[model samples]
Target: MSLQKALLLCSKDAGRFILGTRPIPRPGAGQVLVKNIAVALNPADFYIQKLAIFVDEYDFPAVAGCDGAGTIADLGEGVRGWRVGDKILYQSHWNPDTAAFQEHTLVDAVRIAKIPPNVTCEQACTLPLALATAAIGMYADYAQPPGSRSGGAALTEPWAEGGRGKYAGQPTLVIGGSSSVGQLAIQLAKLSGFDPIITTASKHNFDYCRAAGATHCIDYHATAYEQLPAAVAAITDKPLGFVYNAIALSKESQDAAWAILAPNGTLAVTAPPLVGKANDVAEDGKRVAWMSASVHVGPHQDMAKRMYGALTGMIERGDIQPNNVELVHGGLAGIPDALSCLEEGKISGVKLVARIADTP
Candidate 1:
């Protein structure tokens, strides 16, 4: 086996990633070997480094990256879906050997999505994590339901029964509209016919969020949380259809969300709510449903693939546009700077993607 340089987090201490060489892995059965081209930085990357969420304390020298895009260089046995030269993107919350920070990676065939020729690797990398979370939050199952819309147009028999169709057009609210996941949620909600999709962001991001399909964009920083109910009701008139909180939830935000939700309406929160508790259904008579959007969880994998396929189709057809990506100047050497900027919240409203293959 050949060797490749990768970013490794040898310990849980802050600012601890180190570049070290490791044996380049070959694809196993039902896997594909990829030459990683681009990697996107997410907030979870820093959190994982700080908190060591998935790795054991003894599992030092862990690799850490959740999303990436690349081209297949080799295929393993039983991998019938992909070819040696197909461009693909993947999101995984697994061991570092398969993580996206390295020059080469071996990924499960099922977890990969074919990148359309029209889409750039940088663009594809931006969507996997955000889109998967948005799709899972918007639709109950992996399948897009029949009579669903893709680009403001409707689909015929797009899904089976007991799938995503149940949640269509529910006046959903995507809190934090400027965030990557929030932007994707707005697009997904629109695609699912969720009318009057309301979002809260800074005033400057209102136009961008609207372009992403948010019908109403409120500046949460300026507006009081108590006033959200009236603002949401003015447009929706119906109880809040569905709430997808992209930021960490606070008691004030949760209470505001619950107050506006219609009877039996559901709220799907992505990050930990400020209530400092695990995800749970609130018995506030609003039918609140809290779902953690972590990709490591088992239930997310199958739905992620289906959502990827759908988003790829949409991207190919030019329905959903890619988010603004700030390409970090340095290649692999820039990882530390990028991670630091992300930790300090300096890179907002844009994704920080780096070219990993160009590095020595």
Candidate 2:
């Protein structure tokens, strides 16, 4: 076995990330080993450090990263439809060997998507975590069994038969439109033919949100979140059947978005609900869906496989565009500082990507 450089969490306490070496993990059945070219950072990376939310099961020195793009280096038994050199992108699991912060990582082949010819490693790296968050929140049918809806709004997916433009003439709102997940949410809403796709963002990011398919970009700084309902009403009298709270952690934003939801509508939040009972009914019949953005587990696995199958074509045809990327220097070594920028709210509307293969 060959050793490869990785950014290890060092301890169960999650004190700090350190440069270290671990043997390159071999792909198991139905898996692939990827030599990661680029890795993207998310706010989860920061929370995992400060709160150790996802590292609990691991022993000390866990690797933690969620998004990666690279070329396949090896394929395990029964891995079909993918060659060793195919350029692809994937979301990582919780295990250190499977995480994305390492030079090489293992991924279930079914969850990996081939990169389109026009996309770069950095841009592809931004799609996995954010896109999964938005997709599962909007399309996954979590409500099939009574009271069993866990992750999504229970809407039909755009890639499914007759799912495209399924919601034509409907109106929807996306809180925090400039966010990576918010941008994808806006584009997906457009594909669903939602009319008057409204979103909230900083003034500087109004155009950025609009380019991602938002029909109206409300400046949250100028118009307070408390006033979102009135503003949304001014755009369209249609009741908002769907609300994607990309900034669900903010109680104000969550409440504002929830306040605008129509009867029988759904609000998909990245964080656990801060206002209403998640998956429970209110007097008005609005339901909240809390999203867990893992493409590797449970219903998400099948949803991811179907979504990944369609994503390549979507990118090739420009139906979906990758997020704007800002490369962070120093490879894996730069992630901690970049994560700091995320924690301090210094970065916006663009993903922070690192060329992990450039680690020195």
List TM-scores for all candidates, in order: 0.87, 0.97
Taking all chains together, the TM-score of candidate 2 against the true structure is 0.97
Return the top candidate by lDDT. 2
Q: After superposition, which runs of candidate 2 have C-alpha atoms over 4 Å from their true positions?
A: 143-149
| lDDT to native, each model | 0.71, 0.90
Q: Taking the tens digit of each residue's C-alpha lDDT, what string does model 2 give over 50-97?
A: 888888788768888999999999999999999989999999976988
Give a tens-digit lDDT track for model 1, residues 279-339: 2334654433334444435555555555555656778876667678888776666777788
Candidate 1 C-alpha error for residue 310, in Å: 2.7
Any runs in candidate 1 off by more than 4 Å, and if so which?
140-169, 274-281, 292-297, 358-360
In the predicted model 1, the residue pairs found to clash are 146-158, 249-274
Query: What is the lDDT for 254 in model 2?
Result: 85
Clashes of each: 2, 1
